[model samples]
Target chain A: MNKKWMSITVSLVLVFTLLATACSNKEKNSGGSTAKEGGKGEQVTITHYTIDSPDRTFVEKLIPDFEAKHPNIKVKVTKAPYEQFDSKLQSSIAAKNAPDVTSHWGYGGFMEYYNKEMLLDLTPYLDGFSGSDYNIPEDVMNIYKVDGKTYGIPLNSYVTVMLYNKDLFDKAGLSYPPTDYEDKSWTFDKMVEYAQKMTVDSKNLEEAQYGVDFGFGERDQRPQYFGAHVYSDDTWSNGGKPSEINLTKLEVVDAYKTIYGLIYDKKISPTPAFSQTVSGQYGDPFLSGKIGMSVVGSWSLAAAADFSFNVGVAAVPYNPNGDVRSVLYVDPLFVLKDSKHPKEAMEWIKYLITTEIQEKSIELSGGNPPVNQAAAEKYYNNFEGIEPKGIQQVFDGAYKYGFESYNHLISNYSQINELFINELAGVENGDKQVENVLPDIEKKLKDLLARVNK
Target chain B: MREAALKESANEVRRMRKWKLSQIIGFVILLLVTITMLSPVWFMVTTSLKTTKEMLVFPPTLIPKVFAWGNFSELFTNTDIKFGQQYRNSLIVSIFTVIGTIISSSFVAFGFARYQARSSSFLFMLVLSTLMLPYPAIMIPQFLLFMNLGLHDSLLPLILPSFFGSAYMIFLLKQFFSTLPDELYNAGRIDGCSEFRLYWNLTLPLAGPALATVAIFSFIWSWNDLLTPVLYLDSQENFTLPVGMAAMLSSKFRLAPWNLLMAASILSVLPIMLLFAVAQKRFVEGIVLTGIK
Candidate 1:
């Protein structure tokens, strides 16, 4: 080779080697984490993967206390932004390098973890362990059981409730919606009647006050409330393996049409387009105080903290003939199957649920209710800007009649939901008739289910 | 003679008037376009200074009703976020990335431009083919590879990849370098200068614009990158700017402090804007000279 060619090759190799060595040196210093002197029994550093939220913040704050209590086990909290958190966890699990402990919001996810057999069944832990921290409610405990095996514990929950503007109700001279779920007078039709009274005719979405904002496009949870099924129960039973879309069924169509009518015909609820105009950065129209009532989850309580008027919590309007089902969001924390230190991870999960910690969960998290009954009781009673009795009734109402939507229970739900969420938008926005679109939605949904089920 | 002179002066005056009028119109049109383009940046600046409550107000106020000076302070002082540390981390990674990418890509580009071998075309095609490998397809394998190297949680995974040379940058720099005369390299070799010296002393000084372009693009890409940092860095202390900024937004499930997010965004953008301002001349020249979009 020519001298120039030889010299060039040597320099390139040297440069790369120099950079790679520098990086390795840096990595060496960062990775050589010696046994934390304060810890006992050869300090074990366990990574805790959590999504960014009050829950993650709650975990981060407890890290020091956890480490101090269990000196042998070092707790390292890793919070990926919510968008990346699940994907990263899945990647780590696939790589067999999953974090020792992690959590997910079960209403939208975490079922996949169970379905894929990625979670460590916590039943064995519950059997061998004895502690007051594990005093979760019987119903909640039943939820954790997958084929009689305890899978996880719910750390926090977001129960669906009716967030009403008391000021609007009073201005219209209407009585507050009954907080007691048992009140037969407080029917679905009755709530709509009250809404019609308060809805002021306006020039546009900005000037006009919407009587209700039922979060139509966010997810049409209306079918569950109407005692209607969008799909057969067998589909949910089969974990969505042989699902059928019943969106064209009379009862299901009625449920969807009722909400659709509310936006276009009745003109009480805000249209998806209307809400877009009024929603600020948070996309919350209810917080603007222009709406009479909003049927949404309790997670919205944090956003309502700064409301200019009084807010009331009430049991969501229910179908008297149908089952009184409300969307109950249970966010659980579980140990990964691949966790190297399952015992240490279990220790961390248990410590987070002690009465002291659970009680502070509501206070620290701003608004997310703890699944622990005591802390949850405190959260429902005397919530920010809400009537204590009304909020309690609503909380009780959800617990008594709460059922997770089939979407939450099924595997491949994200994929299934993606298929029709956009196609169903035209019906949701009132531009297309429900009768005309249901057939197409069913076809597309079936296609997706067939593809995903295999 | 006197009449002709007067007529010439009048014509000159008319010509100047026409020229001045069009210039005024062009200036006005460009000013409007610039303002139209920068409105989002302006909104970010204004929103960063507004309270979260005020930011939500429709018909958003161009000027915040109340100046929230606290948003900037809160970005650093907020117990949960380590914006200051992240800012420093981003700088460290981006600077090293620029240095590594410029050196490696240029060296590789020089070989392709000036050197020849029987396998040269085949090897160049091989490098180019790597650009076709989608990130999603290879991300898992690359992540596993890094995990085995014990580099997963460190900033090394983020910076190490750039040193091996990137296909796009090498391609861009090669196009620019091939235009330079072979005589310069030959003369340097005739004087007994080694290949390293020729690259350093003779070729590099002339390739400043292309290198600056690569430097700018690499810095911006590294600075703005969210995926690598999110995948690699687990600890908050090592997070880059984009990851740190995203963490501030919270998520859809909860209330995001947009005011605080906007403030962090403005702060993060300062370095890039300053870079563009400083290297404005060369960056434009590099893109034009390299003929690479």
Candidate 2:
């Protein structure tokens, strides 16, 4: 071999060897024992996977505090986008490198993880932790439990309510919609008629303002609204077993028709084309005083608050026959079964749920509407400029009726969400009518359930 | 009337002659197309400067209402997402990956391109076939392998596999190697240069454009990759920019601060875009060297 060529070959191999050694060094040091104090001080690293990005100031703060409190136990955190969280989580589970703890979305998601045998049962630890005393509703906790075995803790809870423009109400010479706190006279039809009355089109049909603004393209919001209505109002059977979910009931169909009519008969919503031109403009349309009312959540309460206009809050309109009031959704945190440090992870979860952290986190996040009843009492009951009026009253009325994603009941929820979207898109297309659409959906949902059950 | 018509026709001819109108028109069209293609990137850069309220304004403003230098400031202020650390992680991973990919792929490509062995062809085909397998199917198995190897969460999970060379890169390099005269290699053998020596000196140096092509491809792929980092890295300190950016989006109940996200995104892509611009000549030459046409 030529001396020059031989030297170059030797140098390449040398570089390759150096790289390999460096990589090996990195692997060796990447993880170390994060041994707990009370347990064997043999290093025990608690790897927590959450959907929270490293960028969120809250998480940046939370991790340091967590690490500081448990200096002996190393807390490692990984984050992924919400869109890919479930898939990435499932992959982690299958790989058995599943994190010791994870933050997951609401009960529907919590239930899926529970069924998969992927979550660590927290029942043994709950005895030491007084979770029930925290004023998180009994029903909310029940959502995280399966067969009376708790699987996770609520990290944050969100609920949907009727958000109204108070300024628009005043202009129309009408009072804010009432909840049980004032009087119980408000009914579903009355709410609809009021929305219709409040709707003001300009001098031309082309310039007409919408009465109510609703999220149209996204079908996920539909379930949050309808699920509450179905649970409270419908009565039927899941085969031989008795069930309250009967969409076939006249009153139930009427409720569906009434909600559907807002789009078709009223033409109050932005057309699909216009809405698509500017997505998520429901907030803009409502806040700009172009729409009189909207059925939005406390998550959107801050949007109205940011507006230079007046706004009010009310319970989600109730059905007098069913008498259902508010609908609630909560996002929770769960411990994975394959967690390397389940005990330490549970302690972290416990710390997060404490009244102190929950209150402070909620206050920092601007009106998360605390799950803890006592912490909630600390907030002003009647703040004039907070956008949504009687925020606490809405919180009080919230627990009366709650619903979760129908997809959560079944394992293949993504497929069901796709089916729901396509079916609703058809309704939006005006090809398959809403009345015609439900039975096909009902059959598909039942078929999905049977396959899963089998 | 005939005089008037003749005057108008002469005026038209004069107008065409003075402007060289078609060429200028064509150049203008090309310029417009280029600007149109680049507008989205320009928008991303501009939006990074916008305040949160400005980003969500109705009829979306083309320019920032207020420049939020704070977004860039916040990126560095946090210990959780040390922007410098993420950039270093990405750089370290990409540099190592590029070197590994080049060495491994060239070695593998030499066997395919120069050797007459029967199994060489078979092995090359086998490598090509791996591209067809859906990634998610083997995702669990790959994760377990890394876990068993105790490489999970470290740069090894992201880096070590590149040492084996990628099928696509090998194919690219092999195509270029094949186009080179066989006599040059024969001449190397006559000089008593071993197979390794031939590859190390004459072949690789001559294939500089192709090597640069593979290196740039490997660097960009490694830099922008989110899924691998998300799957492997288990600490904030370990996160690359993409994984860190994703976490930022989901962290709060309120929508992610668009200003911060856009600023971070722009910063994340700047190095890569700048690299592409700097390497444009070599990249294009490398593409042509591969004889992709």
Query: What local distance difference test score does each model get?
Result: 0.76, 0.66
| TM-score of chain B, candidates 1 onward in order | 0.95, 0.90
Chain B TM-score of candidate 2 stands at 0.90
- In terms of DockQ, which candidate is strongest? 2
C-alpha RMSD over true interface residues, model 2:
4.5
Q: How well does candidate 1 match the true structure in TM-score terms?
A: 0.90
- For model 2, residues A118-160, the per-residue Cα lDDT tens digits are 7888887777666676767676776666657888777666666
Candidate 1 docking DockQ: 0.36
Residue B48 accuracy (lDDT) in model 1 = 93
TM-scores for chain A, candidates in order?
A: 0.88, 0.80
lDDT per residue for candidate 1 within B63-133, as digits (tens), equals: 99899999999988987777899999899889879978988899999899888999999999999999999
